[model samples]
Target: MFSGEEQGKVQIYTGCGKGKSTAAFGLAMRAAGCGGRVFIIQFQKARRCGEHESAERLGINLAQCPQGRGSGPCTSPCPLLTAARDILKEGGADLLILDEIMAAMRHGCLSLTEALSLLETRPAKTELVMTGRGAPQELVERADLVTEMKKIKHYYDEGLPARRGIEF
Candidate 1:
């Protein structure tokens, strides 16, 4: 929506390895650098993470809906899902990042059907970005660009925890 002829594309990042959300956030930052407004909605997260911290500093519109840890699948009408739906309907930003949304769908916190439906209704000029592992085939087909981060090796495999500012 930054330019008159700019057509927003749908991008998806998914895989077993890390950096899905990170990549999306990086794109958001790049868009912001170009004077584009960015809106990020994080799902199925309960605690404050590095992304949220960075978003605060960058002054991006970041909404986090933390679904508390539980043994069973998440409840219907999840707060995160609702927030995503609202954002899609409202169309408030040039770049919209739905971080970890695929995970929410896979975890049963959100319905894939509804998610796709809402996605169809998003504003034409809003670039859509989705992140998380196990993305549905339908979504993969719908996305204009898709990246999968395969984990051939990782430091976490060697008992290294996620570090702040590096992995959050």
Candidate 2:
């Protein structure tokens, strides 16, 4: 966006690649640098990714939703959306990141209609970034800017754990 751009906006990162969350977190760090209050609701991941354990120390507020045990479902939208709704309604943040959210919706933890409504319910002034693999085509279309990370190769194919500071 140009420096003189209008209000908060929408952006999305998606695809069958390895860097969606990494890209989104990079944006979060940028937003924090601009002094924008931020909240990250990571779905379908447990065991503390390096970002979760470090965001607060770096001063970005985070709330990893308890949606899945390991790379799977996110079935509790009422609670999830409620939290998001409250924050947007109160206008506490300049930006919000829905990390790995589609996996939740895809796995039946969140309703598509409700999840889609965030683009509407969110105070128009709230900027949002959503990141995930397998993101719905509809969501990609709804976004103002959408980047797809196409995977070429990954260590997961070689039976290696995600490398710290890189895979993350």
Candidate 3:
């Protein structure tokens, strides 16, 4: 496994909101903009409708879960956990984002302890960010930064579908 700097920070983007992953990806892009290597692991989100393409366009390394839109809790295997561990192990990136991981774990697609253990073991100096809804308390406790997106207002309530560059 790669060894990172002595210390850095861990962040979590949670709560019922639309921009969790987008925020984390923004941070990744910011780092990459400065020539920092970035690695992203998107769990339980296989549709290419999100920021995946934009993040990739920034030249960040990305590993997406094996499941797709129709795939859910009963999906064969949750490769995201393993892939995330691998991403941390192969460290060198300034930032690593694990998007939509919490919901997947809450659905029994992943063991919370396993995910937490992996989250704790990344090389030093690597900034890590995890995004999803309903993040466990334990994960939240360990995070140095947390952003909760409250759903006070949204166009989705009006029977409107997600729009490009907005909801997706």
Tell me, by TM-score, which candidate is best: 1
Which stretches of model 3 miss by more than 4 angstroms? 1-6, 73-77
Name the candidate that leads on lDDT.
Answer: 1
lDDT of each: 0.81, 0.75, 0.78
Best-first order by lDDT: 1, 3, 2
lDDT of 1 by residue, 1-168 (tens): 688468888999999997898898898888888888898888766778777787778878887765543323565777766776777788777898988887677677778897798679878888999998888999999999999999988998899887877876
What is the TM-score (0 to 1) of candidate 2?
Answer: 0.86
Query: Residue 137 lDDT in model 2?
Result: 78
What's the lDDT of the predicted structure labeled candidate 3? 0.78
Q: Give the poorly placed runs of model 2, Cα more than 4 Å off.
A: 1-5, 70-78
Report, for all candidates in order, the number of backbone clashes: 0, 2, 2
Q: For all the candidates, what are their Cα RMSDs to the real structure? A: 1.8, 2.7, 2.9
Q: Each model's TM-score?
A: 0.90, 0.86, 0.87
lDDT by residue (tens digit), candidate 2, 129-158: 888877787887788898889989977888
lDDT for model 2: 0.75
Alpha-carbon deviation at 107 in model 2, angstroms: 1.6
